[model samples]
Target chain A: MRAPALIVENLRLKLCADRGDTTLLSDVSFEIQSGEIFGLVGESGSGKTLTALAIMRLLPPTIKATGKVIFDGVDLLALPEYQMRSLRGNRIGMVFQEPVAALNPTFTIGTQLICAVRAHHKLSGHKARERAIELLDMVGIPEPRSRLGFYPHQFSGGMCQRVMIAMALAGDARLLLADEPTTSLDVTTQDEIVRLLERLSKDHGISVLFISHDLGLVARLCHRIAVAYAGELVEVGHTDALLQTPLHPYTRGLVRCVPDLTQIGVLRGGIPGTPPMPGHWPGGCRFQQRCPLAGNGCDDAQVTSSLADRTVRCWKSAASVDTASIENTTSPTNGPKNLARNTTS
Target chain B: MAAASVSSIWSVVLHRLMAVIPTVLFGTILIFGLVQIIPGGAAEEAAGPEASAEAIAVLREEMGLNRPLHVQYLSWLGNAIRGDLGRSLTDRRNIAKAITERLPLTIELTVIALILSLLIGIPLGVLSAINRHNRIDAAVTSVSGLGLALPEFWLAMLAVNLFALKLGWFPATGVPSVELGWHEHIQSLVLPSLTLASGAAAAITRFTRSGMLEALSSSYIRTAWALGLSPAQIFFRFALKNALIPLVTVIGIITSSLFGGAVLVESVFVIPGLGTMLVTAVLQKDYPTVQSVALVLTVVFVMISLVVDIGCAVLDPRTRR
Candidate 1:
């Protein structure tokens, strides 16, 4: 896939302290093909956000990361801070979670966008401002010129998210990392943002690393899905294949938890037990404690293997499943019952 | 567009003016009432014990000291509106003339002190914030703590002992005369200004450090850093201005506190300013001189607060709405 646009090789991040360290992300690796939306789905504290932060080199002073983040043949981790800064908004951009609080309250939308444009390029203020207006218009903001003078507080949540998207596209960034971009918006706004992002990705051919806990939304927007469970990637595959036949038990549970509108009189479900904290990860498979199909062999670290464009990190996936029984029993209407039985047993 | 911005500025100014008027009026009334309640009278001070009883009565009548308190207060207010502050009891000079002569020196000293505070305080604050929990921050915090501990008068005395007595770098007392050039006058003003500034500078540094720390951790700052803005740009363009909103509030309070600080610093430095004049007026129970000076000071304090409110509105556009 033309060098996969961006690649991470065995990334490990540790939260450092004066006394000791705690591992946040371990042996995490992934690659993004050009013009593809890759979903990293996990709940909060599952190291999904940490992985994005490590890729962007935006980790706090206390975080120590070890990995090779190769983007467009350049090793991002090895680059000097100054050069990395120049590459950030120019080649790679980020849309953070909260649209309302993400923007600087003191600056107008135009001023901030202009600053973003001028940060990477040596453009005149007038030129940058013109580009800002154009970018705002491109993001579907109505009357961009008139709204240029309005502060972030004047904009609604959806409008602010659009402004954030405009800022991300200000310098024609090649890769966009949207970190839970729609988590703070209304359901309708969430749908609008996802649609807009999909259209932008297709039109510009920009690769996006879309991070969210909402598997359903990820299923719609992303071409590939990487389900993260307790800081470990348990499954990675095409969105359709992964949803149709989730090999990893964690991925199966996540898929089952998605509320199906077609199945009436069905209760929505959630993953049983919270993910383990950073310092207290279980040995071997990180999701073993919570996996319904966990066996004695599951305690041994199993190597990830790929078959027909799908990769699963599980010991039981190697053995064949009774496809008929698995399919017939695992109806959307019976998802909650299965989840409840699994948790009890 | 320019007209709109100007009107916005005016709107802020008007709002601030409205807030300050009552405070100023309240201060004036309190000061006037306090002077009236004090033992002895201006007439007694003007006419000595050796003077005839008839002469004392005449002086008291002329000054309206025998009138009811409310009547005296109203008469004084009416005269003040017309720019008549009556005559000083001791020197027989027009109270307004005396105040005007002293006002320049006090304002000059205050301005110098404020400049010193900003010059030293801001850098110290920035440095402390940048190196939070490190040796630099610790040192700055300790120095500021010490500055706060030492009273203005004691600092002035220490400066006099070190610079004037020990180093022989400056004169021990008195202000430079009008014959001296502005530069020479400024040199004479420096020591007193720095002494007066120490406490304010320390307070400002502490406030600024906390403010900058808070601003640096904000989401916008993180976004700015992620946008690949240079540390300099992030610090100055994003963090510093955001920090200044809180710092400016501290500065406003400190500037008003300067009047109280000036009472001691001005006396210790022995400069011919309002502090010295107020002291003399108080000792002689010179009601007109005391009331006029107090009224002027209250007006200045209110005016400063008004400017600060306007500055806040301009700095933070959300306040305008």
Candidate 2:
């Protein structure tokens, strides 16, 4: 009976840059259920950050967006910016990757955290300050009351991220948009932050639209994951199903690129050519030029067909030949330990 | 670490103030030596043309111009230390008395010019930085460009023509007498102050625009926008504070230059400020008046630099350590 926390349907964006008008997000559609973590996986220049910005309506002046970004049954695109301002950092929170930079350097953690709290709430300054301490404690920061006065420079990388998490939780937000929250931290710090974010999402019953380029980390944390290539969604399904049985060639290429410890002396295979330029992309299949097994009909009308529980966008993907060898050979290798190495690689 | 506590800041300020002693000594010597080397005798100017050569020689000895250069300098420096710059050679009026009388008027003009430049320059910068390529931004840049192109003297003439002779809104040239009301004094300063502020305001505008642009694009500003702070709060609280740090240095430089700039503007308006006094003294070879004005300007300029440095440390916590 309840609507999903966020549903983005046919959300497209184009950048009117100095070069020309180019599509940044082509018909990107997905939905995140409440209390679930959905992953958006992509390589750099794949429009992952752009899609996140589109959800929050934070795109730059050079970019334009159209279609529906429905949140809790309200079409966000239709809401005025005055209304949107209240919704942002209130019902929907955001945690950017560079935790130190994401906070104002001049402001103390307490001041910044309290500002986020009081932005939407009508609490007294004292009450807001108390709430800021509480939020810091909730994010596992030690001695919250004393540490509140410290600036961003005083906190370690991991502690800074914990502060960012506290900031995201300030308004009791229902949906959190995390844009590569761990990309700037080290492997150890990244692991701690990932666990903290996952735990907070569960404890708070908040849905997260997690965006990252690390397939290994996404597989470990997400319930459902979608793969984006060259500003286009190529595959979508359950994390286990999509990675284990990749229906699209681009998805298969990404899966195979994850280093497999079982196959020694093999340094991982990369997708042959670079992701296509925006305005210069050939018509038909956007991936056809990169797809090795491209046949005559591969250049024909590229369609997204639902295969059991997964969606694949390709003409030849419907009658996919044997790719069991890819699944069998490509792995997290030694499971979780090797997965961390794949991220660094 | 630039993180400064109260005691540390006081110590730093104290240290900077002590350095002013040597600077004053060196600057006074330089000014006195340069004035002495000029190709004319103060005795000729002090005495009338019809006076005998014997009268001029007596005047030179009485004025201490006939003494050895070092002996003259020592006596002058000793008298200067006692707050007595002696008497002007040409007018025989006490130089210190003349300075005190004109000091307030010059201070008032420079302060008004300073306030005008900051008011016009900073906001125009913020507007242009935010609007970027819009019509208002283009207009602001072009206006500042015009301010840069037209020297203060030329601008002063045009202002006198437009607002004084043509419109008769302000007095074209004059300072208010002491008995005049405050508004009369302010009204007289309008054209003169505008002329003095134009060039300095142009420099301030350029610095403010670039500083504001940099601050606006910084990560913290994006964070503020992402956090949904109102545009006003984001600008006044976050972006403006960071933008103003660099502007403090610009202000210090401008303020010092404005002090020097007041000289010409004073001459133009015939206000009898220290600038006019210095010009008259230099033309008539009155050593005491020129040397005293130069020393005072130097000391004041250095003091302003100190204040600006301390102001910056206060505004930005990172610089304090």
Candidate 3:
């Protein structure tokens, strides 16, 4: 085993306001190994984006973060904002979710790219321009030299996504945080972006912390996936193992919610009920309200439980999936589809 | 690409210039018609009531009052186009010459006021927006509110009383001639410009604050922040450019209004600019002087508006179309 690129140890964030201090991320913990594509998967308002923002130290002033965020053996949380700023865009880069608004509308693509590069490195103007062109080309843009003068709005949505990727990679960071990078894109662009990101990570040997609500995309791209629910990391395991036997009830719920490509004609059902609001979480397992296997035992507090090279945060995991096998196993098509998507991309 | 952009810019500039013509023409007719409707026509006002009917007839004939209003307008418009605004009825001085003499001082006052307003307004506005709901924001708001509430003439008089009469830091009234050198000229402009610019500055501060607030909250700004560019870079480079687009339009309106605003401000400060000249000519019912000054100011406003439109297009590429 190698040192992880990032280790988020019991990270927590609370929004401090005059009315009351609301804990947003309550004891979140995860790690991304060097060169690994780690998926931080969750639904909306589950504090997935907040965790990414906390790692970047880009959270709002009202939102206070605590606990360790060690990147490559260095404690990030302990760094002053000045030092943290140097790490940002230098050792760590981020691609925001909305491609269109991610760029300064008034500035040309080349200017922004060059700025992002030069902000970290002491490159001369000529060298910075060259770097910008190379970055753009790396992101699969055509005629990179000519496209330099074009503004953000001049580019199509897909093209803008490429430009944003170019900018994020401009600093040559070791870890990349992509916050739902493909959510705003069309399906074809989303597919292309997924492939691009995977290829880049492989080629550069850079770690990617991909935050997304789309399970299919996450399943396709990430080697290891962490399921988050209501500010809690409910499950973490290798992709195939987790899919074959989703240890946590929430993970099981997510696995079943994925439409079986084999049974397309059959109606698909979603996990009922929303994740509880951060502060208003249930007294026991956060997912118990929506877990089908809920029992008196489920009412007990759920904590991380290690079982066979996987971490599951559910009280009834052994009985639910370990013995009977995953409910999603009926689809022989499921495993291959995810594998195929990943390989092709 | 360079050639194409240059050509496109030409087209935009030409389009803006073409737009100026109708605006100036419409403005002239409106000003002329409004002045004619001021109870007594210029000819009658020039010829006192005690003057005999035959004397009044001759005065009216000399002033071309007997002609149809449209014909008179066309002739006056033609003279104006040819740079011959006839001569002032009261003093027989060339109306154009009188305007040209006062033009430089008025322009100087306006420019100073504009620069001062922008210098004070933009930073304060950006700061207020950045620190919204804080003490600095509250103070800025209150000061701007005070500026907006006070009348320009009252402000001018008050400024003179405080800064000039009491402090003895400036001349009490009237702008020095250009021959006095740039220093003296600038010195004379301070009080008048302050009085004229404060109201517009107050408004600009509000517009800038609101525009900056909107830009600062935009997703691009958030992206900039996330990219780890310092807060200053995100604000000055990213947000300020977007914020200035709308502020440019507001400034254009403000600049155009300053020409008309000079009338009261000049009177209060006793500056012998076009505004005060126009006031004196109006009181004496100098027909040519009044008509020509009004026409000149209208054209100036149209020209300024065109420039501002182009500036907006430059600042915000999306507005080019």
Better of 1 and 3 by DockQ: 3
Tens-digit lDDT track of model 1 for A55-144: 889998799888889998988989989889887877899889889888898788888888999988799988888888998888899899
Misplaced by over 4 Å in model 2 are: A1-3, A17-20, A259-266, A321-345, B1-82, B177-179
**Regarding lDDT, does 1 or 2 come out ahead?**
1
Best by TM-score: 1
For candidate 3, the docking band is: medium
lDDT of 2 by residue, A1-345 (tens): 445899898988988878778887888888888999999998888889888888888888889898899997889988899988888888888888888887777777888988889888889999999999999999899899988877787788789888987887788699989999999999999898889889989998999989999998899899999999878888889998888777787887788788777889876766766888677667788888877656688767677877555777876666552343435433333332343354446
* Candidate 2 clash pair list: B1-B321, B2-B320, B2-B321, B3-B321
Clashing pairs in 3: none
lDDT of 3 by residue, A1-345 (tens): 878899999999999999999989888888899999999888998999999999999887899999999996888988999988888887898988879888888888888889888888899999999999999999999999999988888898889988988877777689999999999999999999999999999999989999999888999999999998998888899988887767776776688678788987864555666788977988878887776666797777776766666777876665543565546543424433443343345
What is the lDDT, from 0 to 100, of the residue A94 in candidate 3?
Answer: 90
- Computed on alpha carbons, the lDDT of every model, listed in order, comes to 0.84, 0.83, 0.84
Greater DockQ among 1 and 2 belongs to: 1
TM-score of each: 0.94, 0.88, 0.93
Q: Against the true two-chain complex, what DockQ does each candidate achieve?
A: 0.61, 0.42, 0.62
For candidate 3, write residues B1-321 as lDDT tens digits: 445555666778999988888888898788778767777666666677677778888988988889999998888888888999888777778888888999888888888889989998999899899899899999999999987888999988988999999998888898777677878778878998988889888999999999999998887887776667877888788899999999999999999878778889999888999999999988887766888888888888887888888887777766655
